[model samples]
Target: MKLIDLNRDGEIGANCHYIQIGSLNLVIDSGLHPKKAGRRAAPDFGPIRGVHLDLIIITHCHLDHIGSLPVLLREHPEAPVVMSTSSRMLVERMLHNSANVMVRQKEEANIPEYPLFTHEEIDRIAKRLTGIPFGQAKRIQGGKDDITIILHPAGHVAGAAGVEIHHKRRQIFLTGDVLFEDQRTLPGAKFPAGRFDTLVMETTRGITARGSEKTRLIEVNRLIDSINDTIQRGGSYLIPVFALGRQQEILSIIHDARKFRRLVDCPIFAAGLGMDLADYFDEISRKTKHVRFNRGIIKELQIKPTPRKLNPGEDPQQNGLYIISSGMMVERTPSYTLASGLVGHARNTIGFVGYCDPDTPGGELLASKPGDQFLFKACNVKTKIKARVERFDLSGHADREELLEFAVQADPRVIVLTHGENEARAWFAGQLAEKLPKTKLIDPVPLQTYQV
Candidate 1:
């Protein structure tokens, strides 16, 4: 098989891959860079420009994975897109939200090439996107070659999947942003127990070592304690989350805490696309049994929408829990704006519960020490970091050791790493070399082709 990493800048931005097995041509994931804008954010499809794509496989609905789907479909009009049934249900909503965000950015950030694809284009392309049931093998043909594709549950989010492809006597698996440990709202991954010819995996948390004592339950309790302490101290708690998965997961977790009477009696505020996605998740849970979310959680928790007109560098004084979007706390986002005000107050707390890119505002804040001056450039606010900033080990991605063990057990002939920073990938490269000495490890340079 031959493969090319289509991501332009590499380092976990714009995830796109093109590969060929026998006579088949396939592309897996067409994602936009979370920190990049305009055309540069999209994958460099120049290598596959004239190559007729036989299939486009999407692993999930996160913007970083599916944000560029419409753009890719616009270019390859005939290639059919396939994903797990749950992802199919969520993809359009996620893409529509992306288009809406791009439209807003076009006006606010003055990007003329924003709204890369319109709503109409999404509607037109929706007909070509099909959702296949998990564990069901679908035979796809290209030229004289045919391969059977099966999607396995990847427990990162509600609709995430790990792709398994069988071509002739060879088997290949691609772990797309996976988490093997279960969470409050979802179960852990259920990958097949077997060997494979090739393994492509995500090294998202490879550089971060997990402490033996910091289990999920312990982290959950610590988070609850932190929130209770913040609220008791008359300060608000902010958990910036990814709307698609992390928001829902955090809500479910908070709901559990409240049900057990472990949480303090404080008003909970949450708003944004995540609240709307709750309804979608509820429907999915009822229909597919793949997710476990209920829209009634909002009503029971008495969740309130975030106030629309929030002043920068001024505390809202809600003294409640605020769960908002832009997990990375990107500039101009609600989390970033609220963080600006909260960071200036010593009583408040900002707790992170998911992965943050180092270049993003969230990661920068995490790297800073207390009393350091932090800047909210988008809002033109600068203040001393008096607030308590904490991070919990509740990330959606799998742990480094867990991922390493999975790859080592697979015992594949070749291993390809994707969706991580240089340091993270380097750690995995070093560990895999030491553990699986003979396995060919290929970290493809962006836009370069390699035969495996």
Candidate 2:
């Protein structure tokens, strides 16, 4: 079996992998980088552009994992796309939102190729999608070989899965952003307890061991305390969250906190694609029993949608709790716009609930001290950091120790790490070497093929 990293950055951004097993050629994911723009954001598809891929599997609907899917489908229209049923619904909305964002960027940023793929193109790609329920093994003909693919629950998002491939006598497992611990909305993964020859895993949180010491319950309580304190001070709170998993998880946390009286009743506002996804989460949870979220919570809590644009002097919603998207607070996003209106006021609080790219606006804001002056290039505005800013390690990824434990249990002869930066990978490499000295750990060089 040969594996190649298609992403230019070996780290988290633009995650994609090409796997060649005997006669079978498959692309794991085709994603867009959050930090890059235009073609640069997409994975390096040039290497496998003309190759005949037998199958394409998307593990989840996160933009980093599925963003450039339409572009890839346009290039390889014959390949069948496979993902969870929830991902199917979520990806469609995500791609449409992506296209709209690109169009807006074209008008505002003057990028000629901003809208890399159109809604029409996305529609065409959607036709090829095949949603498979978890735990079912499907066999497909790969040239002269029969390949069996099984998707196990990943517990990362509403419908995330870890893919298992069986070819002949060999088995390979590709963990696409897995989480072993349960979130408020989703349960933990239940992967088959067995060994594989090759284990390709993500090392997204390898550099941070902090999560290992803190439980999700602890983090959730801390978040509730922060919100309560902010609201009690006659301040509003803003949570910039990822549209898919984090938004739902945080909403559940807030809802439960209010029910227990840990948090005061306040007007809850949400905007962006996450609101649309909440309906899907509700449907899937009811149908599949995959998530703990209820659509009724949205209505019961009276979550209102924030206007697309808030006026400059619109007095910080007066003790409202705003859950907005563009988790990284990307420029022009609803979170960024709302934050711009709220940050200048000392009475408001901007809370970060998940991972933020260090280079993004959200990360920058987290690093800034109170009373610091920061410039938001997207809105071409500068504001004082009078609003309280706090970040909780409410990460969806499994803790480093959990990953180490999983890897040890998998007991693969060859372990290849991806989806983490150099520091993170290096840390994992050191840990794995000490614990499993006999195993070979490989950090993939971008575009380079490795035979296992």
lDDT of 2 at 374: 82
TM-score of each: 0.99, 0.97
How high is the lDDT of residue 439 in model 1? 98
Error of 1 at 72 (Å): 0.7
Off by over 4 Å in 1: none
Q: Report the C-alpha lDDT of model 2 over 1-452, residue by residue, as the tens digit.
A: 88889998779899899999889999998899999899999999988978999999999999899999998888887999999877876789888988998999999888888899999988877789999899889998877888999999999898898999999999999889988888889999878877888899889898887844567788788888888888888988999999888898888888888788788878888877788888889888888888888878888789888876676434556588999887888887888878888888888988898888889999999989988998887777788889988888888888888888888998999999989988989989999999889899999999998987
Off by over 4 Å in 2: 211-213, 312-317
Candidate 2 clashes: the total is: 0
TM-score of model 2 relative to the true fold? 0.97
- lDDT, candidates in the order shown: 0.93, 0.87
